[model samples]
Target: MYKSTLALAVAVGVLAQQANAAGFVEDSKLSLSSRTMYFDNDNRDVKRDARGRNGDNRESGQGFKLDYISGFTEGVVGFGIDAQALWGIHLDGGKGHHPDNSSFIPSDTDGSAVSQWGRFGANAKARFSKTEAHFGSALAPNLPILVSNDGRLLPQTFEGGTIQSKEIDSLTLNAGQFTHAMGRASSNRTGLSVAGGTQDSNKFQFAGGDWKVSKDLTLQYYYSNLEDFYKQHFLGLVHVLPIADDQSFKTDLRYFDSSSDGKNGEAGYQFSNNGGYAKNTGEIDNKTWSAMFTYTLGGHAFLLGHQQIGDDGGFVWLNQGSVVDDNGRNEGAGGASFYLFTDSMINQFARAGENTTFGQYSYDFARLGVPGLKTSISYLRGDDIRNKSGDGSYNEWERDARIDYVIQEGTFKGLGTSLRHGVYRGSGEAGADMDQTRLIFNYTYSFM
Candidate 1:
């Protein structure tokens, strides 16, 4: 954090010297985004916590994000800066409704939701030729190996330095090193670690590239490692075949290979194997693959996919759920995202030896003369999940549906609203059965 801050300060100083340069202030933009959300989760197989309260969560909150982006200064090597401010306000839900390990909202010392919380972050960037470098605390990477989460009031951010080069005609290269992460709902930053691991690892390095082989085909490969934790490699391929003027078929394939690193199974650095069977408890070892096919015709689209997890263990991703503060309180780093089709609203059907099949259908209302409306429904089912006893397996399923609309014109133009709901049911080592719903409203105002 200190190094990133110092680097940012130096970049700011350099930019200040050229504040009046031609492109510096002329191409700047500012925007303010607002979101209001209501969340409800009903635990069907309710289990009481230490406070004797059922494991149900209901809450409402408002979030605001302010951003400023300045274009690079004119020169052989251009410099720029980006800044962000986020604030979250809790509007409803009492202690009984807020879980001790709530990931959607930050908690107070007394175990209730915090009234309000906020954070500020900035990035300094430089560009030369077709390459760019950014150093900051607001870095959000959406690569094959690492994905920044944004399912809550604010977005999860990382303190890191990243470089991207597009010098090649049809290829892009990316590399980065992240040291810490700021949770979506918390104001503090913490080191990175995997699920069920109480200790933190400060270094996470990744390098990858994407090559557009042709107009309709692309391939990707990436490698990442977290010190004393795990190492992962990813390969992906995407191709789109045009069937007609308004019809197309898309195929997406992804695979991951992962294994343990130094101290991966040691105390405070263990991996939970995602609560499923593990070849060696607390060790990381897995291979997973998925293929998705989509067919689109006019305003209608259909998607189907299948995924399989290796029997050795569940898939692994960067997670900080077990990292707590000195007082043993969760530091709001519980939520994470993986680049997978099973990253559903209610549950991730990713476990050892699990085989999942899923499908979805969506429609755009524009074809029906309602330009700004859309809806989709999806279902996923996974079976043959290995159990710890190593003698049996289990199964689980989830159904998710969502609707969205935006005011296309008028005073509320660009205002969007979305309603999403999910139902999950499982047995054996699967997660608890639950129904969850979220209603959100969003709007953004831009200033140039």
Candidate 2:
């Protein structure tokens, strides 16, 4: 299916390209980016222990990628192609750096770190009358229902086709279907699934739109389904109030409803609700909601948020089996992300009956004569997380800090660096307490 999809995509683009050859090669762009990352997680006493989790898991790696984009041919229906090549290198990861759990670096067959790994992909695109369609194997989608994970050395990629249309002003529509995913930690492509189950689902479909009611108000709704795992619907609202020329207030709201699908309740496909409450045992059933308010003025921004998960079950999203390890070949149990304010550096507080309160303060140092520098601090506390005892619950909290800087001038104008640290503590079923730190370096250059 993956090969066939790419073949068809190329055929369509080539046929369309023959109609209009103007500006096709003259407007092409090529770019290269390099990223160096260091990750450390120290797990403290808590509860359950998975197969590859350890008291301390640390690794360092580097990634280099090259991208090429061809301009659309001039015609009623323009055509283009985007290609990507990624390479990952292991810098430092000692023994016990198992491939099953290490996200930033790929492990070898003997549970050791591989010296290097790489993958390649391409995307074919066509444009017509203010609308475009993209088909092929390299897609990163940012929608209310699902968000691609890019927290590690490399970003995840999906194999499928997506379309976006803007037939009417102030309104945009999107739809797509993905059949496979290549995890950040693994080089091979695999089917999709969720936590607690190793079964792979071959289909993931989604459609949504954002409507701008007015200049300051917008509404969004998206629906997503991962075959045999679950189906989810998302709703969002955003409004901004201009208090003055330099200050403003913003309100953002999000909600999700999820339910079971085919094979969800089968023996090997049954879910455990992620160690949280569920209306029906070993099934997917959940509702989640969150609201956030942010105030920005000059160089400072303050944010406050609250989130809650229904007692029926924990919120669910995509996970390509990155958790399971069969000797070392990738079978896809990887991580993923959803649209939520609490998906911080260390935790995602989406368990059943969990109520979380969070806040953040950020500042740009440019106001202090330090350009291209910024810092932020955030904290989250979650409680009343449903436990097996039904009436009883557990509690957890996390604190995070981050600093980032990008060279704005001189020989390294685009060089960027970032540092992040997180401290997490939890009681009850939330699992082990841990401390995590990440350091990153990035630089990108473009040529035409």
Per-candidate TM-score against the hidden true structure: 0.98, 0.94
State the lDDT at 320 in candidate 2.
75
Output the TM-score of candidate 2: 0.94
True-vs-predicted CA distance for residue 106, candidate 1, Å: 0.8
Best by TM-score: 1
Off by over 4 Å in 1: none
Cα deviation of 230, candidate 2, in Å: 1.5
Give me the overall lDDT of model 1. 0.91
Worst window of 10 by summed lDDT in candidate 1 = 320-329
For model 1, residues 1-448, the per-residue Cα lDDT tens digits are 5667787899899999998998989999999999999989888888787887686789999999999999999999999999999999999985598886788888788888898999999999999999999999988899988889988888999998999999999999999899999999899988899988888898999999999999999999999999999999999999999999999999999999999999999999988888898999899999999999999999999999999999999899997748666667776778899999999998888789999999999999999999999999999999998887663469999999999999999999999999999999999668789999999999999988
Scored against the true structure, residue 3 in model 2 reaches a CA lDDT of: 72
Residue-level lDDT tens digits of model 2 in 1-448: 7475659666655756463587667778899999999888877773334645563668899988899887788879888888889888889985554434566676666656788888888888889998999887778888887788888877888888999999999999999999888887777888777877777887899999999999999999999998998999999999999999879999999999999998897876777676777777768999899999999999999999999998888888887753455674443226688789998888888888999999999999998999999999999999998875564469999999999999999999999999999999988677679899999999999987
